[model samples]
Target: MEGLQLIATGGALPGRVVTNEDLSQLVDTSDEWITTRTGIRQRHFCAEGETAATLAVSAARQALERSGLQPEQIGCCVCATLSGAYATPSTACLVQKELGLAQDIPVLDVNAACSGFIYGAAVARGLLATRPQDDRRYALVIGCEQLSRLMDMTDRNTCVLFGDGAGAVLFEAVEGAEFAVDLGARGDMAIETPPCGPIRMDGRAVFRFAVDALPRTLHAVLDATHHTLDEVDWVVCHQANSRIIDHCVKKLEADSAKFYKNMDRHGNTSAASIPVALNELAETGRLQPGMRLACIGFGGGLTWGGMLITVKGSAV
Candidate 1:
């Protein structure tokens, strides 16, 4: 087991709130169809000048402010996304520049689709471990996405299931805190985002993978940490679908109350899902200091992972 300061979390959604009724105009799907299938009632879409990097900065700024730490104190930045507006300046770099963070720290983007934020956190942990000189070792892990730009309205199957948003988790190292993580990737392409094309996904195939991944990952990290399902206060899975979480709850025979979800409003914001839900918990006063949580994510690259974290922070 390891430790995390878990300083704070913050989230940002686009200005354009597109409802299922609105999407019906652009595609052949209806609110009933999307709700019954994905449990998504609405989603946010970026307007002019609202790129992934901008959203990342917004979320990270909120987190930094809440943590009561100046930007220059941040030790590193890791942004996870599949929809960065540009390939040259990674979203993490843009966040560092816009936030006035230190220029010499590690700043890079990670791509593991829906499972990206967890990966980014692991990367940040490794990077922070290498720098023993820094006193406050804060690392900002951001999961930002702009999937609306890649939505193919013609293909209602995939188009109606994504949105644009960013979630930033800011944390530092704290001793005597319990932590465990497990990450894995299986070779598969049920979902993909091509270079010049829109999003493509095999919905049924992904559902199968997700349902299986959730419990296995929850058990993986929980077991590694010598904890049980009862010991976990929350299980925040990737907000991909309602049915997937429902099925996994039944499979694990765990309390449904422990699972937190927000996909209904945000849709599946790719890598932003879990951290976004965490931000919601914080904003709503649900996440508190010392609460035990198991966070899981699964998606393209067919990557999947989960980690156990004990919340640490002074503010709600």
Candidate 2:
């Protein structure tokens, strides 16, 4: 059996758009200062009544519809997020409830920071494999965050680097597909969240860790799949910073165009970044059938993960 099949992708962002100029009014930062460092021009903020669970459900609905599968057909639900509406009921459980997915299926949320979607997908695959053999076992994997609520808006450092969003991908277990994954953690606290306190991050430390982690995970996944960088159609890394991605592109001597960047538009949505970018690519018809993609993510927990997949389904 192929590792996992990507059936479709979906994403959601808050209605409120926060531009660099808008953030400048809140903090002692300028448009130039923010863009030069993070390459983020704008981001979204959840208005009242919009939570991480809401975004996750919305994204899941779209992906579920695109897959053309009834709610009862979904066998698993995995959500990746650092921010959830309620600590008790996980975001993935909420997706299952909102989407009316099967109650007997495994549904849970995982926190791997930005590397969540990769880890969640891996977890979903393993869980689905244990179920009764079926023609096509479908799983809904989502990454969502309402980091705006978790940040000290007055603190320009961490505040300016995040956005609120969610992304979801429908995965189906199919024969003859190709999927490989590599996951690791350094057990560092370069980024952390205190109990009932705003998020805290050592910018320099996390930045250093990310640059190193991205390439390591990328190579690990490629190696596990016995593939080369030259064969990759696109490299979707965590949308943390422009310099971090640019550095890797040059270091590996990979095609600059192959590295996709939407941080300029959405900033870092943590766990949601990679899948959100995937949804954008799919919606725009840029990600099509018969393509190979390498997705990498690095963030808090000092965690990192990479996955290589051969596209077998089209979004449109």
Candidate 3:
């Protein structure tokens, strides 16, 4: 009743699955090398007619169905993405039109790279925190990205490290369902950021940043929520690399069983990673009502964030 609660979640991926063998034909990397380094075997790419908004609409519609909410009932739409399919039209507005949302409904885009989902979640949290508890309503937050289009097919380093996908969650204010989100950006690390033109990465440097940043972010979020490591049931982080995930868990001394990962199928979808991972946890029945879930992500922009959340139910 006082803070934002997750009501439902939905995710969408491309119909086409690009395997490492397929990538081997396009680049010099092999399936074994890709899997050893990134734990990604395959990932989805958007089909002919599936743009960002189309995938977003598909996800939002499923979230609405799970939440039992009509199109007009939503207060706003928040889309977190980097590849929005256009330079001018906001992807949020496109999803709004596709959903037939009300004219006055606000829709905005957040471009925080992989941290976008938690950033969007924090935005919805702030909105809920400001509104009257009795009248506070729902906001659809979706993290969707089409990284396949941005990949440099010839660059063996980055080509096999990304895929396209989308994931969505419905948030509303309710008692006992709350989150403690901690976010930060390192502007000074701008020199280390990826290029603006295409996907470029210093895998070793990124590995170092993730190893250092994630543990601290996790502690900050845990402290903000007054939660102990033992209290957390699941850790749903951006599926960037299995090695980074392992390193972060070791740094936090978190239970290995509670850390969820499925990057073997979906590479770094950038902003879509965490939500897609969350949706996977939901599908597997690992993320359940009354469970405490922590989400953490780091990506380009040299940005990162974490959210310590308490789930209310499947149908909040």
Number of clashing residue pairs, candidate 1:
0
Pick out the ten consecutive residues of candidate 1 with the lowest summed lDDT. Answer: 1-10
Which 10-residue span in candidate 3 carries the lowest summed lDDT? 188-197
The per-model lDDT (C-alpha) reads 0.89, 0.90, 0.81
> Model 2: residues >4 Å from true position, as ranges?
none
- Whole-structure CA lDDT of model 3: 0.81
- lDDT leader: 2
Error of 2 at 116 (Å): 0.6
Error of 2 at 224 (Å): 1.2
Model 3 misplaced stretches (Cα beyond 4 Å):
129-136, 188-196
Q: Which ten residues in a row have the lowest lDDT in candidate 2?
A: 188-197
Higher-ranked by lDDT: 2 or 3: 2
lDDT by residue for model 2 over 231-273, one digit each (tens)? 8998999999999999888889889998999999999999999
What digit string (tens of lDDT, one per residue) describes model 3 on residues 158-199? 888888889998877666665778899875343132333476
Q: Show where candidate 1 strays beyond 4 Å.
A: none
Candidate 1, 14-107: lDDT as tens digits: 9999999998998888999999988999999999999888999999999999988988788899999999988868999899889999887889
Better of 1 and 2 by lDDT: 2
Q: Give the TM-score (vs. native) of candidate 2.
A: 0.98
Instruction: Give the winner by lDDT: 1 or 3.
Output: 1
